[model samples]
Target: MSVDMYLGPSKTQGSTTTTVCDNYGNGLNSLQDAVGNFTADQVLRSLAYDSAKGYFKEAYVPLIQGAILVVEATAKAVAKLPSDYVSEVDSCDLKSSELEREIQRYETQIQGMQNQINQVKQLLPVSSERAQHLREANGLISDYTSAKAKLEKQLQKLLAFHAFSTMIFTEVTSLKSAVNQGLAQVSGGKGFNANKGTFSNANLNDRSWMDTIGKKWQDREKERLKDQMPNMDGLEYKQIDFNGGKVWCWVKKGRTTADPEDIEKSFLFNDWVARMLEKYGPDYFKTDREKGVTDLLVEQNLRLFEEVRTGIDSKTGKKLTPAERLARGASLVNSLAALGVGAKQITNVGKGKAGQTPKKPPIVGSGRKVPAIGKPKKTISAPGKKIQSVKGKPSKVKAPVKGTGKIYNANGNPDLRALRRPQFDEVLKNGFPDGTKLNQHAYNSLFKSGRKDIMIDDIIDALNSKPISAKPGSVEYINPKTNTSVFVNPTTKEIVGIWPASFKK
Candidate 1:
């Protein structure tokens, strides 16, 4: 018999459910396929929409802004003799802020020019002399837009350099102090030890793993996998302090192949440290010099710092002159350009000649259509208590047309019958737009996997099967022949997850 283990109360903690599927892997595959189909453009638009709604500012900006101030203060306390450092950083910061105001003014002007062009096109004749008016208007907006873009590039450089200089000053002084104090020794406990490990040069170049780990540990939403999978006996839940934050973790019990100690160390070394560096640019810890520095988005440009500070290429052992390192480091704009959300390109300051122009990574998806995407509505339920649907205007769901063989209702909701594969894929890729919530575990398993082949359609298809009586506040939909099952949280009408029906059998 195949037994699947799920870790739950995921909603209150990580907001993610952990599922270990032991037998059939089809459920996961379907989700991977769906995620793979999302274009880079779609991802960018979704991010922009969320930002416009103040979601990112509310959730992230304060912690990061505060951290950066703290980091700079500590560096100043520990280091002495560089009279120019503080003055240079302050100059860059002031210039960047001014450039931002200039860019915003240009954006407003361009938008107004565009509106005028639209009006001219709509109300004017196509005569050559009149067309010149349109041309002048278009040309004006074009020139200003290009100018704004250049200012943006300049601003990015200032920020990147500011961050880079701070990192070097902080680390060099901290390392020296720790060595003198004999506090650079390796250690780990329930929390992380940041001073004792060596970071990969590769990590400095490609920190996408940082994003993966961030989603796994930080961006999770409330979800419980155990509600969907009952009578599972192979998993245990425990609490561990992850960098002073008490969070829940799941472990497979009696597993000889995987050591929990090794797993914890991996999290500390890779995930925890990555978060620290990305947030603070330097190590984040309380020191006699100052409280820990909290900042944001430094890991994005650490490649140049890593190479210059070490003075040799970790990969090829190529030595760079002090002048060469300074030149490359000074091209801060190239490094910072890759800092865009869902950036398609990266600035590679690798083995190339010092003065060689690095290729710029452009933000992808300009003028592409962004599909409407939103979060699923949430529902809450206490453990052991019956789950109930949210009280709202009842869903206006209707049945499919008789003998039409259609799987969707006229109102754009999924019906009880299985939808066509393409329709199913579209619905799942865009999220459960009919207000059905998807928990973090299910979302991450499908989209967060580096590569997979599952579609949301498969789970929705399984949901079309005959309903099974479940424990209070939950329902199970199963298709026996396909061995596909879906767990639904009745209280919120959320789809808890899709699991293999064979396990229940």
Candidate 2:
């Protein structure tokens, strides 16, 4: 049996009911099929696999080599230098010197280009040849500017890496000494404890002990080289600092990829990646946030992340202003009491477990009792009815409808016509016909809304719930059970359109 998942009214505030994912596991798999087409997911998959292999080889490999060189130098200094001068040979200090020299070189080149442009501009006649020279000089200047910008960014990362490496200088020196000793033993020299292990003078070149020592060294290197590698996390919503702004990203939760395919496989299982990409940019999937694409997307779009995390005022069903969020407890209580309920907790009720299937949140209109956690139960007790309690006592009576979204006629009674639609009834009883087709309009709506992950079967399942008529020969079937809706042609039995709870504005 599929695990039952409940969703609140965050996505469908005006709807009569909340959502429930009855087939949680299967429905999530279908959503995965939907997210495969997202550009952000595609970008992450590429970076963590073969497609970005060439880029890593050309760009990251050199950074790794440079960092290793600095590491080796620091280790040598720590081992051989006197305590007083050891600080002078620090890796970060050495990198800063190199970065200064590189910056000076770029500045000199840019100055020369500017001189040529100035000479061209000062010419008495503006000839076509002179204009061409001016254009070339300007182009050269632009290239230098871009190259210098990239170099500074890369060097900054290297500096941070070198600084971090200094914390482990003692360990690196010890490992290096061990490696040197192992080499000496392999060459029949007096090094390592030959008498303590199986490596006697006769079996000098035996590599069994060396292999074990090498494995330990390799593990340390992996930890040291994390900055230069593409490390992907599992499926989860993790808040990370990206491009000077905080954003919630799926690709960077607190974990590491076990295999190359693990990164891509993780992407196949969630919509947070799609939401982040749609909110920020394609760089949302970049493994190295420190060395990622430098842009204003994150800074510009962080409000959405904040809203998703903690913004909605539960009592009013409106976004809480910054001032309102930070108000003194008394003022906050008073304001909320003025709006409606004073005791309601104003927190994100829909933040589910890590990598859990995220259903559309309920748009909680005023006066509805917000659940203390997650969402209300999958079933809504019929209005005005009392069920026998688990203890076998009659439950308290429920009040009649207020201004909530439950379907009601003009005279304020439950609309039975909406409660019973024959087309939906037949589909729930016998399933859809073989020739039933999803039309172009529905596909367009889903694609534009980042909900192309909603499958046709999901729509059919949603039809099992109550429906309200929209027009002649058409009915709006909403199923909170499946978190999907279908506008159906009762006579033709074709799916005219769909509205999925996954849709985000």
Candidate 3:
């Protein structure tokens, strides 16, 4: 065989291969695979078998030297990093006495970086020392690479500081050239920011550090825009201040119309948002109060936040304004009173569990003025149907009665309010899908010819009684007499707000 060529224990070497062995490469592969899959103890046992010539130890001699060299190289690189204040104090000409504040700031930053690198080191497992040579080599390489990359990104910042330091006390021309060279080494593209007084457009591969702040800002914007639009309605635009000196030109709800003023404002706001994204690069939201590409591409923050609304009736497909809600509330109130239910009990219902706490009803006399609720001049009581009051006081039958059925116990007594609960449950089971705003017409239609007030509180209490899969915001109930269904808002215990079973809008 020639000195440069090898002869192996095979008769034939075929195709692309120039050499072959009798055991072939398979023996080496199987041995290496064994090293990976064999129990650590098994490997230890095998390694423990003594060779009279100390053959296993001899085999690792070169590997041990290589490990020593690699560890030395990593240690030298780590040492090159300014992990100590002695280096910082020595590198800068800052006197020990000249306003110690600046020196402390630099020292603190150096210490922080060192601490971060140490934290990364501490993450290595305690068992790593058992694999000391290989583990040390890998751990040192990973930690050193991480620390170096982190520090490299800030080199320009450090250079600027150096330049500033020397600008007052020494020449900065060489310092600027050194910075350009450093930038060239650290990041290949873009350099020399005169405005920022540092390098620009370098090392931007991972810029997600700002996402946390951006998400936080987005949530704040969503909450503000949804909180009743702050005395404005329809489409409009407003410039709001973002934290940390950032600014937002937000499209919001205001007086929306196709008037010249409104058109011009809309056009200008759209133009401004477009120009900002084009000029400043990608952002998360297109406009504060509207949907856009920002919603499509991001996670963590909500994509869109719709304006706050009073909501629409599910049955009639009509918007429920505050006045309408109040009217419906009053009607439900009348029904509850006729069934001898109280407002306080209705408001305090559903406080049994942590998440099931009920919201208080919009109380009358709690600020908003409501018409005095005296005798309805009309009652759910049938005409000419005189009955004894709960206190056993005889009362005259009221004229112009409202409801359509006997809303009392089988004994013909209103005081057995528990008897009324079954009827309420019956209404809950049969009358509504959920959030159904029952009025005189709907209530009257619920019966054949008599009047019975379905107390709004009774409706709320009944609705809460039905079982629902998942934590539902509402439940459905049916009116068996009319075979009509309605939906009720569980949170408000109101007969409106949720979209009704019969209505799509």
Please name the candidate that would achieve the greatest TM-score relative to the true structure. Answer: 2
- TM-score of every prediction relative to native: 0.20, 0.25, 0.15
Quality of model 3 by C-alpha lDDT:
0.30
Worst 10 residues of 2 by lDDT: 368-377
Give the lDDT of residue 126 in candidate 1: 76
Candidate 1 on 239-336: residue-level lDDT in tens? 33333222233235653232455344323222332333333343233222211111122322355445544556545789954333332332222122
Better of 1 and 2 by TM-score: 2
Error of 3 at 462 (Å): 20
Name model 1 segments beyond 4 Å from true: 1-94, 175-505
Candidate 3: give its CA RMSD in angstroms: 39.0
Q: Write the per-residue lDDT of candidate 2 for residues 1-505, one digit (tens) a residue.
A: 1111112221222121112222332354454344333422434453234323432332223323333333443323332221211232211112334444555666686776676566556642477755665665566567556656655664454445444434434444544454554455444333223355222234234444344445654764674443221233334433233333222223434543223343333223222322433433433233222321112223322443344335455446797543233221222222122222222222212211111111221111222221111111222122353321112112221211113323566897865344323223333343443224455555456544345355433553355345678788878777544567678787876677776666512
TM-score of 2: 0.25
**Which prediction has the highest lDDT against the true structure?**
2
**Considering lDDT, where higher is better, how would the candidates rank from best to worst?**
2, 1, 3
